[model samples]
Target chain A: MKIKLSELFFVCVKIGALLLGGGYVIVPLLVSEFSEKRAWLSREEIIDFYAMGQCIPGIIAPNTIMLAGYKLRGKTGAFCALLGLTLAPFVAILLIASFVSLLLKSVVVNDIFWGVNVAVIILIILTVKEVWSVSIIDKLTMLFFLTAFFMCIFGISPAIIILLAVLLGTLRAKFLKGEAK
Target chain B: MTFLLLCFEFAKIGLFSFGGGYATLPFLYHMSEVYGWFSSNELSQMLAVSSITPGPVGLNVATFAGFKTAGILGSFCATMSIMLPSFFFVLLVSKMLKKFKDSPVLNSIMYTLRPVCAAMLAAVAFRLFLESVVKFNNFSDFVFNNVDFKAFLLFVILLIFSLKIKKDPLIYLAFGAIAGILLHFGHLFA
Candidate 1:
């Protein structure tokens, strides 16, 4: 179907406005909006895009939306979808950030953040647990996790660590493939 | 000049940050350390703000960091730069969707990259834990006085509640804010 750029943009804006915590949260919303509600895309296609989004760099929500947009109406569709997806949150964050300093000056705000900080720790811990279930499946992966953890603790840059993992992972996979041959 | 630098740094972050939103934390932490654009304490605050806000946590934090460094224009540059990499990457992948989907090399990279990303997040969690929940006076001293029991208690409660209920993070964060206010009043009375 030839989806209008404005229609695509507005739909994505609605998604952006509802994107509360990021990550896989966008999946159900995308399935509902694009597949179930509007019929602009299929559920399976949305899932595929989401899986692809996870593997790629950048935030998954916009990445997935952009891919869907590209599929729908090529590049312009993707751009509009991206603009729609980001515009709401961009303005919202700018507004909050502008007043953040003034808000921080208030003791109540500070105290609330104090508690919120602890809450954030809980959130991070949950994230670690969630990632752990998917990422650390065996000894080799465990070693990868440990290596990166120690490197980070020892003050190595994360960008370098990620690069090293890519090299190591690719090499290991290649060796395993050769052995299987 | 600073805008260009922001674009460069965040674009790099965009290109490299895999897995999900929190994957960007390690890079942001490193950026904070390298540039002092915002302190670690402020990073945690930004994390909190990003969490409770209406968008991707990674994007929101980038916007906050940009705003912190160079105001509105900085934020615009930072947000756009971060998304730019994804724009091209996704477009490229869309054309080669079949090949990309079945590529063993990509699978292998993700196989290891996932753990690395998780580990980085663990490292970030550890740092935030020290800053917000506990403090060690020097590295050697381990004492009860060094621990913030109030924060510790709050952490335990929130963790348990989150695990059991599994609601949106916003709910827990809202509860946290209320708890914080109440705790402050309790401290005042005490």
Candidate 2:
């Protein structure tokens, strides 16, 4: 089925609003929607967009939206999708900002905020599962995941994690050579 | 000074953040440390709202953190600074994507970053978990009336379903939301 440029505009809205967990979480949804539901793109094409999006800036979702939009309707599609995705949340955040003083003041509101906070750990786990295939090549990576988690748990700063990751990754790449990339 | 720092800082996040929005967490941690504008705990909160709400996490964070630090102008600067690179890069890349779209080097980079990025997400997630679940107000209270076992069970159950079902994340999220509501009603769990 041929998807129209205007429909791509709505795709932007669907992605921007409903797509949560941010980052790569949008990928599986894009796969289900565009590849399976809308049939806008195929499995291979989605992977390609993901690869290229990773190589570039901002967030994966927006860049993927841009690439997907451009694929369907050129620059015009890109602009509309970007607009639809960016505008609503932009306005919503502004509106919420108007209430920030009040919202931040309530203890009950804060408790709920803490309740919602519990979900983020799950979000990250799910994100890891979604983006798993590329990263965890072997037990070395398993070790990395464990080490990283423990370090983070004990209050080691993430910058240190990044530093250690870069070092370990480089070492692994040296031994693995081309496999490390 | 803070405003200018916001622009420069977000610009750095814009340029280097790869994999996805959450991939920027490590950088956010660094920024928080450098400027001391926000704590890691607050950064985690910004992240929770950023993910669930509309717009990109990076974009939401720029707006949220910016507004927190300064005000309206911080929002503008944060949003614009984080977005400017992508807005222009999108225009530039869409033109060239057709030609170099199937490159192998791009594949290699993504493949490598994928694991590192996931680890980054996991790291942030772990910290958030400790803050939410592992806090101890007092030893006696902790010994007798401690542990939010219900939350932990809900998380585990939802995690199993999500991995097993492997469907849309919205299902797991809905389960999470419902769990939150149910947990709030003390009678239900008790």
Candidate 3:
């Protein structure tokens, strides 16, 4: 299970550079690279990493890669993965910022951006459907989805909602599932 | 001092912004009001560019905002600091994850978290859709104004195609850009 830092870095760098949309889309891309192609991790492990990404505080994409890299080769692997992921966007945006003032104008650029935005939104919605079918299993999970949805819409912070879910989940495990020690 | 301040502020954002990239929008909006680093309009433009760009939306905006406030160094600091928290956090949590792998409490937490995550994803997707596709100032405006029919139609077409074909997303993205230019040119003639 010893992974070369160079390989980890390059794989993540490629993913960071080419993958568009947002964090949710990163999961499928990672699965294809690590699980299907490399056999680095199983598909279920990637899904677990996706879940762990959600539970954590910061951005999902970086966190997921960190876990993947760490699982592969400990601390160095994690740093390599993180560096690979951030390096592309940092350089890309910095380059773009130089001419952003000009780019913001030109109705042509705006039109292209508007079209790309629509496409990215569609990509996100497709991810939503894919995640939803797997995540929502029964009445209780449905209730969790509804509660989270309303709480998000009502301007509640996501941290608070996630915290509340953890508390409720722990309680359920303790009393209802009867697995508490 | 400015570099440190930028790092601190972005670190705070990275620590707090949950759900995903779009969740950071509210905090960025607040920064515009208070910090004067970037305007709301510029933030929207950054968002658009970020969406089209190859990385996470939040990180891209942080870089743009930092570059706007100071320069290239500022962009580096802001991006690094924003991601710093997650870097340390994953290290810590993943270390502990092994010991707690079989704990029922952890299992239940994840079970419940899946649905919550689903809801958060759906909410952000819907919000982005409304912002991009649906245009109306108010309820009355909705009644009086026409929806962006072309964008809506394109969305439906792409959605169906993606679901059926299951191909790479870049194809749809390129198609969208082409369609956009054609539609814009078509409008010019009319």
Candidate 4:
């Protein structure tokens, strides 16, 4: 059966709208969405999409959506998925604006947000752990995590840290003796 | 001039931020600190708002930051800037997927990005932690009372549970929320 572009569009939007914990959550969801639910793609294909998604730039989920779109329908599919995924949060945020006053101002609610903020903290740290397992390895890479941790916690400039990491990472990649087989 | 500059700035994030959207946090943190387009507290609030909402945290953040910077137009410029790169880059990659599918050059570039990504994420988490835990306002309270043992104790308890729990972040968030509610309303808790 030929897939309608609209169905593909909503798939991306639905995934973006209800999903939690951000990009990492998208990883497994992509596997299930394309491989299991939609049956439009295979598991290996989704992984390939993820690899490509991570390799390029921007954000991962949109990239993944683009990849999934391509898998489902080709160029038009890719852009449509991108548009759908991108628009979801943009529209959601816009709607959220009307509630911003009450959400931020209420005393009882402020108490909830205060608690929620710490939970956000833990959630972020969990995200860090999830990404760490995938990206960081070796002593040098580990050092980068430590350095960045100290600089940020101490209120050092993040641009400085990013530039330093880029420089150091480039040098390490260039100068290191061994090649991965 | 302003619209183009804002696009260029966020576009840099699109092009460079490795690991993911959170990786853009450091660059953004610096933007807030150095440029004063947005304040540190505002950025923290943006981050919290982004996390609770659905979709990519990074994109949500860029939209919030942009909106704050240049109003609706800024929001448009910033969001589009970060987005365009990935759209084009992925398109380009998809075209050449077969040619570079197994290339070592790609692997090396990705490897080099690992630490930078870590640093970016660490920057984001650390800033959030400081904003939540560190109190710059109550400086005198430190010397005179040392009464923040309550906050300290909560942190320790939360930290332990966070580490021990299986995959639930909501548990900690709920824990923090309950504690906050109790502190404010419950007389016996304090």
Fnat, model by model in order, equals 0.79, 0.45, 0.68, 0.53
Interface RMSD of 2: 3.8
The top-ranked prediction according to DockQ is: 1
Could you give candidate 4's per-residue lDDT for residues B38-93 as a string of tens digits? 88777777776776677788988898888878877788788889988888877778
Residue-wise lDDT of candidate 1 within B1-190, one digit each (tens)? 8888899999999998987787889899899989889987788899888887888888899999999999999999999999999999988999999999888888888889999988998998888888777874247676768798888898888878887887876777788889889987987899
Q: Return the top candidate by lDDT.
A: 1
- Name the regions of candidate 3 deviating beyond 4 angstroms: A1-15, A20-57, A71-73, A177-181, B1-44, B65-74, B140-143
The lowest-lDDT stretch of 10 consecutive residues in candidate 4 chain B is B137-146
Per-prediction DockQ: 0.76, 0.38, 0.53, 0.52
Q: Which is the winner by TM-score between candidate 3 and candidate 4?
A: 4
Interface RMSD score of candidate 4: 2.9
Model 4, range A1-181, lDDT digits (tens) per residue? 9899998888788877765656667767777776799788888888888878887777888888897787677788898888777777887766664476667786666666666667666666666777788667888667767776777766676555555655765565566535432
Lowest lDDT sum, 10 consecutive residues, model 2 chain A, at A107-116
Q: Which ranges of candidate 2 are over 4 A from the true structure? A: A1-15, A18-47, A71-80, A104-108, A139-181, B98-104, B136-150, B187-190
The per-candidate TM-score of the B chain, in the order shown, comes to 0.91, 0.81, 0.72, 0.81
lDDT of 3 by residue, B1-190 (tens): 8888889888887876665676566567667767788876577678778777888887888888999988998998888888888888888888898655677777787788767866766666665566567864346557424667788998998888887887665676788888889888987999
What TM-score does candidate 2 get on C-alpha atoms? 0.75
Local distance difference test, per candidate?
Answer: 0.87, 0.68, 0.78, 0.73
